[model samples]
Target: MYICICNAVKESDIRDAVGAGVSCFKTLSKNLSLCTDCGSCGKKAKQAFHRALAESGASSNVVSIDAMSTAPVRRIQSTIKVSASATHHQKCIKTIL
Candidate 1:
């Protein structure tokens, strides 16, 4: 069912956003832009959102600000090459091959 006609937001969209860890109205609005237009669907959308959260078993105590971000997560790769890991001053040619 469509919750917000202005933004074309549906009930599934709110549920999906909630499943993705959107715990508050701000994040839900940022993600779906649901109740930002004429404010008519605000109450319905909020109810659906809360219902979805309850159905999804999400706690109100936990918060995730990044849940609103659609950016893909990235990992930083790094490498360290130690020539000599010994405490001695001996000349050792250690290769990480």
Candidate 2:
């Protein structure tokens, strides 16, 4: 789907930008000229941009959740407690080492 017909920017392009660390509206405008001209697509573009970001986040979350649900969860071993007084500070003889 085309977000800005004037600039020939597509939804996929926006998604790609979002994936490449383009987070906010200003960065998006600089990258793709979104809402730069007549600004007719401003609202729609913002909506699509946010939607794309949300979808990407949701997809990643789903993948992680699925992996957690399917993978074998191991039981934790015995927990160890150390006394604060047991801590020792060793000085390196090599000054910087």
Candidate 3:
């Protein structure tokens, strides 16, 4: 998927960069600039970063994906749910009056 249309940065581009030792967001921003422009693709870029890290055996850098994919097959496990609203840094949880 094309995460950054303005820069022509695809998800695979980010992944390959991650595999080549670009692990964290700071380095990713500096190296790939996937999230520096419009800011619309930041979240997806971050997701692709972590996925790339996990897939490339950078297990310590990526927690959530590793937890989901390589987690033990035990009886009970905790799952972290991230809402779309949260992705864009909006706190949408509300209370009824």
The full ranking of all candidates by lDDT, starting with the best, is 1, 3, 2
After superposition, candidate 2 runs with Cα above 4 Å error? 58-97
What's the lDDT for residue 13 in model 2? 90
Stronger candidate by lDDT (2 vs 3): 3
lDDT of every model, 2 decimals: 0.62, 0.58, 0.61
**What TM-score fits each model?**
0.60, 0.56, 0.60
Off by over 4 Å in 3: 61-97
TM-score for candidate 3, residues paired by index = 0.60
List of clashing residue pairs for candidate 1: none
lDDT of 2 by residue, 1-97 (tens): 9889999999899889878855555567778998889888887887777787787783331111122344332211011123331121011111111
For this target, which candidate reaches the highest lDDT against the unseen true structure?
1
